[model samples]
Target: MLLQVEPMIPALRRYARALLRDTSAADDLVQDCLERVITYWNSRRNNDDTRSWVFAILHNLAMTALRKYAGTQGMHVAIDDVAESQMVARATQEDALHYRDLMSALDALPAEQRSVLLLVSVEDMSYADVARVLDIPIGTVMSRLSRAREKLLRITAAGVPAAAPMSVLRRVK
Candidate 1:
């Protein structure tokens, strides 16, 4: 069981980091997830994929944390909290700007959409696996992923709709 879970650590960390946007918090969540998996290992169905099972554990823990945090201060990602090295290593100003924009867009996403997006795009999990991990239908996972992509595009587009001028409508008497 340890060997099976070891190979998935890096991917799990990446997904966790994307969700929490804080390295230490992400690590803590991962640790909690691993502990939960070990504690419940015997109860899990044998036919289930261990990888998906572990991921499901992690996702549940993240959701719980989000809820806890939301009750206190609302869930949010601190883009500025990211490591300085990561922010400074971009090859050019344009790349840095784009990266920041993408991160902002991701941070702006609702938790459900963000979770599905990261599981699919960052962890490279199949849609079916993501659905299992998130405990949603596969079609719902696809829909969330699609909406996430569209929102990101709109956020990064040349003209963000939110920033556009509002037109005044005059009513004829």
Candidate 2:
């Protein structure tokens, strides 16, 4: 089982990083996820798809962390505050701008749509597997993915960040 899990580490890390948007926190989440996977290994159904099950575990952990932090002012640092040495040099200015734009568009998506998009496009998971991991119907997964793609296109085309929906915007108490 360990051997089977070894190849999945990079993918898991990428997924976690994208979900959390904080490197250290994402790493800790992945560690916690691995621990849970190890502790509950025997309890998983033998016929279950290991990849889907593992992703489901990671998703659940991420959701819990998100909920836990939902009420707090999240730690956010501006790019100018970071040291120049920490920034990776892109091959071209255009590449860096495009990358930034794409990431911004992704960040603007609702959590549900973003998760479905990342699982399907970034991680290359099937609709069925994404449904299992996200605990949504396959049709819901498809609709979310479609909406995500359309929103990304709109955001990128307009060269403006999409506004968060009213429900997604936290009210200041």
Candidate 3:
């Protein structure tokens, strides 16, 4: 049982990070989710979809945690922060610009749609699996993802470039 779930840690972490948008908080959510799974998995033996079960657990945990920390999301962080965390900085300038455009488009999405889109499109979960994890109807998942992609396409086509990433430390001249 322990070994079965260990392999999912990275994926769980990635999903948590996308939803929470903070590394430490995301890790905490993953930890809580795993603990709940370990303690409760035995009782739920007929679990048809372990992936969905784990996701349902995670979704509940995230929602509970959010209720406790209502005003501390820091206004969803900045658009560049999410992109900078994902960027490799190895692409050509044009590619870099396009990548940034995509990120900005993604960043423009509401947290709910962004998360659903990431789980389904980027994470490659099926619509059913995504609905199970997110605790929403498959139809709702499809609708939100469709809207998210459409918004992204529109925003990127507008050719708007966000400000460059900022340096955290001041350099002595």
Candidate 4:
């Protein structure tokens, strides 16, 4: 059981970090989720998808923490400051700017849509799996993903230069 779950740690960490945005907080959440899973490992159904099961556990824990923190302190994004040297070494100016724009667009999305988008795009989870993880209907997952994509594209496009004019095609029977 431990061996099976060990391989999934990196994925859980990535998901947690994406959701929390703070490395320490994401680590704590993953730890807590792992603990909970270990406690109930025997009770889990044999036929269940272990990856999805663990992901669901992590998602629930994250939601609970968010709710508790929201009531006490209100919700907000926590930005991590990077050292100038490290930043320069990571990416070129254009790449950095594009990454910043993408992150901004992702951050601007509603929590529901953001969750669905990350689960699908980042984690490569199927719509059905995302729906199960988020406890939403599959159709809702589709809707949120669609809206999130449209919003992200619109947001990012604002920074790009307009394309050259193109002729419109019309069909007449």
Residue-pair clashes per prediction, in order, are 0, 0, 0, 0
Task: Tell me model 3's lDDT, rounded to 2 decimals.
Answer: 0.80
Q: Candidate 2, which segments miss by more than 4 Å at Cα?
A: 74-94, 163-173
Q: Rate the local accuracy (lDDT) of all candidates.
A: 0.84, 0.90, 0.80, 0.84
Worst 10 residues of 3 by lDDT: 158-167
- TM-score, each model? 0.78, 0.82, 0.71, 0.77
Candidate 4 lDDT (Cα, 0 to 1): 0.84
Instruction: Score residue 154 of candidate 2 by CA lDDT.
Output: 90
User: Best-fitting candidate, measured by lDDT?
Assistant: 2
Error of 3 at 169 (Å): 31
Evaluated at residue 121, the lDDT of candidate 1 is: 89
**Top model number, TM-score:** 2
| Cα-based lDDT at residue 19, candidate 2 | 92
Model 4 pairs whose backbones collide: none
lDDT of 1 by residue, 94-137 (tens): 78666666777787788899999988888889999998898899
Query: What local lDDT does model 3 show for residue 5?
Result: 81
Model 1 alpha-carbon drift over 4 Å, by segment: 71-95, 159-173
User: Candidate 1 vs candidate 3: which has greater TM-score?
Assistant: 1
